[model samples]
Target: MKKYGFGVDIGGTTCKIGLFETTGDLAEKWEIPTDTSEEGKNILSDIAASLRGKMAERNIGKDEVEGIGIGLPGPVQPDGSVLLCVNLGWKEKNIPKEMGDLMDGIQVKAENDANVAALGEMWQGGGKGCKSIVMVTLGTGVGGGIIVDGKIVSGAHGAGGEIGHITVNPHESVPCNCGRKGCLEQYCSATGIARLAQEALAQDHEVSVLDKAAGISAKTVFDAYKEQDKLAGQIVEKFARILGKGLSNIACVADPEVFVIGGGVSKAGEVLIQAVNQYYREAAFPSCVHTRFALASLGNDAGMYGCVKLVLE
Candidate 1:
């Protein structure tokens, strides 16, 4: 008799579900498109149905599953109520109750997505042996997760590790979706890369090749960097400076043993890591320079794997 668990990572774009052995190895994965409407119950119902179907197909009973865990792309209260999630259009919804109801009394744990990602990294990715690590995802928006002493730090109100929302520039004041200004995300995410590239293109319309590549995005900029596009270099360099400063700030407080960078921008590989590390080393406090920067190893599966880690832990 083998024990298993179900881990679900619910995002605005998709819901990733994984069935894993108690040992944390993912056995199967599935996904469904996310519908971010006030009708979030539909999402919960669908997940329940999916899990039931999986159990039926495998000829397994619910009793065999140790628990069901979820990572939501929103603030999950300690009591399992979602305070607010712009991505899911959820407001004050008791996600644990709702999800448990669907599962007929199965135990469920819910936490913020970033925290889950960190758990996933610790379970199967680069942070496996480490006890304290910070995982940063640089996608359209930036997100962060902190793992300390082998536990996810979900602060009061479950808003712990909201690193992207950290204010890097109060005076520069660029708007963030969190309704704030000058957040670290505004300068370090893939969206930020595009914003920076656009600004550079605006500044020098004549000399750069990006002008010819109108509608260029972060990918284009990275490609251009490989081709030695002057504008792209300038933009990424600036991005590195801001990103490094943000990491250093995080380091000062968390004093994490390792800083893992993941998401779309992370695909830029060594160049991005090296540049940011250089900045982190310079800006970080004396002892903080010892933290090593590494690329995220789990990729998209981190969320699902993390959910498993949460419940099994």
Candidate 2:
């Protein structure tokens, strides 16, 4: 095995790069803007250039490095072909081939960004010490990654672990970004929480502190809930109920040992976890009721760590 490897997380705006020992210690990390102009023609070249410069500066020989493991913002086949990445202006392309050609003698592996994040958590973050885990990321939209026996289940068509798209409210009138209605994302994401708060505030003229605020956000709702605001408490309960039920559904299928929650909304801390756990326990099947819950520890570095994990695997 090589002594070191590179973990590259390609996001829509910036690509986060990390150097790591094959044993999983991150030696260095950095980021560079993702130039999406010209249909992202220069993105790969830019990454290759930056990596070459870094290697030269460190006097690191190519033989000492395992390979570059990358996380893409879209579905990726085992062969490292990306089906599409709207955010990066990418279409069907073989990532490993192109990247390997750019960096002679260096190998490349790629996986979906969300799945890589789950692997990252499983390796050294919230899911550490566990062989199976389901990670739910509650950002603008909910994202999920499933890991079992320390391996990612990318699924056929590379759409496995799309937990957010699960239908939680089949009756919802508005369509989701995926052109479907009632996805779990519509009710459990950060934007979903804010939307719930807005709907709640508009449905009733009840006296509340939220009405005086400039805007309603997930943080605003959580802060109010923490302060013991009655309306906020109700809103949080609803959010927790929906999220917990969604997690319960996932548990029924994946049966992971732990459910790691991450993303911006997780900053609400244990209160959020406790609330969600409470609902999860109530809804989970008896056989899975004891499933543990945890907050993701790696934060934004998770994807990069998972990227390295791919090469190590």
Candidate 3:
């Protein structure tokens, strides 16, 4: 068996790379600026060069390495082809073939960034010790990854875990970035939460601290909620209701053993978890009602760990 591998998570700003032992330990990690110039043509070559340098510095042979696993911020088909990654300026391409060729016969696997993060959490973070798990990332937008029996259910079209796009409201006039209306992302994401706060404050002259705040943000809302401010509590409850219901809907389909919440919004801590869980319980199927909820522990590194797991798998 190969003793080492590389995990690469490509983002619009930076590409995070990790060297890992097959035993699941990350031995080294680093980052490189994403050169998205010329439609991201330099991105793969840059990663290949960096990996070669690392291997040479460590006196490691290709035979000693398992392969490279990459998580891209886009939809990755089951065959390791990426349809498009707008952030990376990537069009349709086979990532595995491209990266593998540049890496001199080493194997390569590719997956969507969110799914890989879920895999990472299940393997070594919040969902560790669980065979089935759902990971929800509440960042600028909401992202999700579903894992069943230790493998990602990436779906036939690579859209398996797009939980954020689920329609939560039919009357919403504002369309989502996906050109859809009333997506869960419009209610549960950090930006969405802030937007909600703004709308709530606008609807009525609510006597709340948020009105006097210089800026409104998801963090501000959570902070205000912590202070037991009434208006903030209302906004948070609305956010929690939508998120919890969205998760319950996911549970009905995937029936995962655990739900791992991560991303910027999750930093709100136990309060967020408890609030979401309360709604999840109320909405979840009886059999799934007891599914555990956990905050993601790996943070940004979750993708890297998950990439390694992909190669190891």
Candidate 4:
């Protein structure tokens, strides 16, 4: 008989699940559509149902699994209740209890999605063999996770790694969902990159591919950059500059050995990483030059692998 562990990443639009063997290998992966009706309670129930369906399809008994780990989009309390998830439509819910009930007595653990991704990188991805690491995810919104001494370092209230919410421009505030202004996320995420490109085009009115797109997106900008579009190059460079500043701020405090850049935008590869690395080195404090920047080894599955780690390690 083979032993297995389950990893689930619950996002606003889809839920990703993976089964891992005891040997730290991914055995199977699956996904289900997320239904956020009722502010996420529906999504939670859907996840429970989907888990059972997957287990049945795989012919696996619940007892054969050691535990289940979940990576969520909101702040998860140390006790496993989801404190708040504006993106997921959850507010003050006992996720562990709810999911555990659906599991019928299985061990279930939850952590913020970004934190889970950080743990995944630390356990099996880019941060392997390193005890301290920082992971920055540049997606629709910027997210981050900090790991120190092989454990997630979520400060009191589980807000320690909310790096995106950090204020970049104290004076020139841009509205944030958290009721703040000039947050790093507003300036560095994929959305931010698109916004920057839009602003550039708005000011210049140049003849660029991005200017013609009905919907401007980070991917469009990146593709434009690859084709040597000067405007797109400018957008990418601006992203690097802002991202580097954010990393520098984080480095000054956490001083991690490596910074793992993840999310869809990271697919831009060396072009993006090199640009950010240049800025990070330039802006970082002189003593903070020891940090190495790497792309996330695990892609979308990082959250699932992270969830598995949440249970085992």
Candidate 5:
């Protein structure tokens, strides 16, 4: 293996760049703003310039570097071509070719941002020492990455791990951002949890702490649940049931060794794991019922780690 590599994780607002030892230790990290202006035409150029500057500053030659791995916030084909990336305003872009060319023919690999995060977790975080894991990210919306046999299952069309859009309530009227109704995101995401709280509050029920809370969020509900608030308990029960069932279905398909939970709502800590696990255990297939559940430990850096691992492979 080469002595060093670079991991570039591109987001809508910023691109996180990390210089790393091939042994998996991060050497240095920095960020560059993503210039989405002009349809993001300058995004790659800016990243390339920053990378070159870093190399010069460290006095490192390209010969000592393994490659650069990029995590993009959109579907990535097996050949590293992206048809569309609304977040980056990219269309018909071939990431490896473009970035590799910019870097003087150095090796480059790219994958969906969520997929890389899952790979990162599998490599050095929650799922470390495991060969397979399903990472569920419960932020404003639900996002997921599936790693099986130590590789990302991006699937045909690069949409394999989109667990959030899975329809949990087919008969519901509300549509997801993807324009489907009753997606798992509708009830299992942070926004979903808060929405559930709002629906509960609109009804006649027992006096609860949430009634007087400044704002209702997943944290508020979990906090109330910790305090044994009956209404919060009900809301949490519903949220957990839906998420657990969703994961149970995933287990039947992917049969990963573990489910690594991450993103904003996962901040609830052990309470979130226990709550979801309780229902997952009840509904999971017999053989998959024992699949482990753990919180994601890497937080924001997971994508960069995964990107770096991409080239290591």
Candidate 6:
């Protein structure tokens, strides 16, 4: 194996770069602003230049490098071609082909950002030691990645692990950001929890700490639940029921060995895990009921780590 590899996680604002030993040890990490001007024409070239500069600074030769693994914000075909990536202003681009040409034909691989994050978690973070796992990121909006047998399950349209879009409440009149109604994101994400809290507060219920909190957020709801607030408990129960049930449904399909929960909402920690697990246990198929649960340890760096792992594979 080569002695070195690089991971590039491109976002709308910046591109996070990480240099790593092929053994999975991160050597150094940094970032460069993403140039989206002119339809992101310069983004790949800029990344290539930055990587070359890094190798030059370290006096490393191209033969010692394995290649680069990239995480993009949109769907990627098996050949590392993107159909459209609004975040990067890219309409139709072949990531590996373009990046390889710029890097003088060094091998390159790419995958959706969320899927790479899951791969990162599976490699050295929460799901370490497991070959199959599902990673759920609970931020403003819900995102997910499914890895089965150490490979990302990017679907035909590159939307494999879209756990959030799974319709939980077909009766829900409110539509999700994806223009769908009653998506799991409507009730399981941080924003979803906040929406639940708002709806709960709107009802005339018993006095609780949440009633007095300055702003209702996922944090406040969890905090109130920790304090044993009656209303907060109800809200959390509802959230857990939906999320656990959603996961149970996923278990019926992917049946991963573990579910690694991450993102800001996951910071609520054990309390959150237990609540959701209870519902998952109740609704999961008996054979899959014992699937483990864990918290993602890599945080924002997960994508970078996954990108490196991609190249290693």
Each prediction's TM-score against the native? 0.91, 0.97, 0.96, 0.87, 0.97, 0.98
lDDT of 3 by residue, 104-143 (tens): 8899999999999999999999999999999999999999
- The C-alpha stretches of model 3 lying farther than 4 A from their native spots are none
Of 1 and 5, the candidate ranking higher by lDDT: 5
lDDT of 2 by residue, 80-106 (tens): 887778999988889999999998969
Question: What ranking of all candidate models by lDDT puts the best one first?
Answer: 6, 5, 3, 2, 4, 1
lDDT of 5 at 199: 97
- What is candidate 6's CA lDDT for residue 61? 93
The prediction achieving the highest lDDT against the true structure is 6
Give every collision pair in model 2.
none
Give per-residue CA lDDT, model 5, range 74-163, as digits (tens).
Answer: 999998779999999998998899999999998999999999999999998999999999999999999999999999999987888999
Backbone clashes for every candidate come to: 0, 0, 0, 1, 0, 0
Worst 10 residues of 6 by lDDT: 155-164
Which ranges in model 6 have alpha carbons more than 4 Å from their true place? Answer: none
Residue 236: error of model 1 in Å? Answer: 1.3
lDDT of 2 at 257: 98
In candidate 3, the residue pairs with backbone N, CA or C atoms under 3 Å apart (3 or more residues apart, or in different chains) clash, namely none
What's the lDDT for all of these models? 0.85, 0.93, 0.94, 0.86, 0.94, 0.96
Residues 33-57 of candidate 4 have per-residue lDDT tens digits of 8888777667877777877887898
Candidate 3's C-alpha lDDT?
A: 0.94
**Sort by TM-score, best first: what order?**
6, 5, 2, 3, 1, 4
Candidate 4 lDDT score relative to the true structure: 0.86
Against the correct fold, how does model 6 do in TM-score? 0.98
